[model samples]
Target: MVEAMAKAKLWTSPGGKRPDATLYAAILSDMRKGKGARFKKPAPGRFMGA
Candidate 1:
């Protein structure tokens, strides 16, 4: 996934910018992946009231 993203030109930053395209892309990708996994269904009886 990282390789694919790196190759897609999805990451971009202005010239002389503090953050390069690769860094921005990585952070964005990580944020997206993190959000995707932030919510997980609990197993039966795992919660206070199953």
Candidate 2:
């Protein structure tokens, strides 16, 4: 099961800050193994002084 899912691609937020290629690859690897998707923190200074 894990192997099958791993074959599938992982998705990332396009609007998200530029992510490290290696880190993204790792996350995708994990997700493919049935691990939950990783959520990125909100972009810095997005709501500053709100």
Candidate 3:
């Protein structure tokens, strides 16, 4: 998950190895956006496009 996002250049700032966790936090935040979310977790430690 993080590998794909990192390769896609998801985060512009806070660059480097920080994506290991910051990415998940950012992704989880979107999940709380209700119907406008950017991602969804069908299972633990797993993420897919919403």
Candidate 4:
């Protein structure tokens, strides 16, 4: 997913991590997952936000 997802300066800013795969491995790396996840994907191709 790292090589797949586009890397941008915003991800690097504020001392962010490298590669997008890492985030996915950690239940979205502290973003979204399932069952008590921080986010909810109600609609297709849309994030409800944090």
Q: Which candidate, 1 or 3, would have the higher TM-score against the true structure?
A: 3
* Candidate 4 lDDT score at position 3: 34
Which scores higher on TM-score, 2 or 3?
3
What is the TM-score ranking, best to worst?
A: 3, 2, 4, 1
Candidate number with greatest lDDT: 3
Residue pair clashes in candidate 4: 26-29
Model 3 scores what on Cα lDDT? Answer: 0.80
Where model 3 places Cα greater than 4 Å from the true spot, the runs are none
lDDT of 3 by residue, 1-50 (tens): 66765578865437757666787788899999999998899999998999
Residue 29, model 2: Cα distance from true site in angstroms: 0.3
- Give me the displacement of residue 21 in model 2, in angstroms: 0.1
- lDDT value, residue 22 of candidate 3: 82
Please list the residue runs of candidate 1 whose C-alpha ends up more than 4 Å from where it truly belongs after superposition.
1-19, 35-50
Give me candidate 1's TM-score against the actual structure.
0.29
True lDDT of residue 50, candidate 3: 91
Total clashing pairs for each candidate:
0, 0, 0, 1
TM per candidate comes to 0.29, 0.31, 0.72, 0.29
User: In model 2, which regions exceed 4 Å deviation?
Assistant: 1-19, 35-50
Give lDDT for model 4: 0.45
Clashing pairs in 1: none
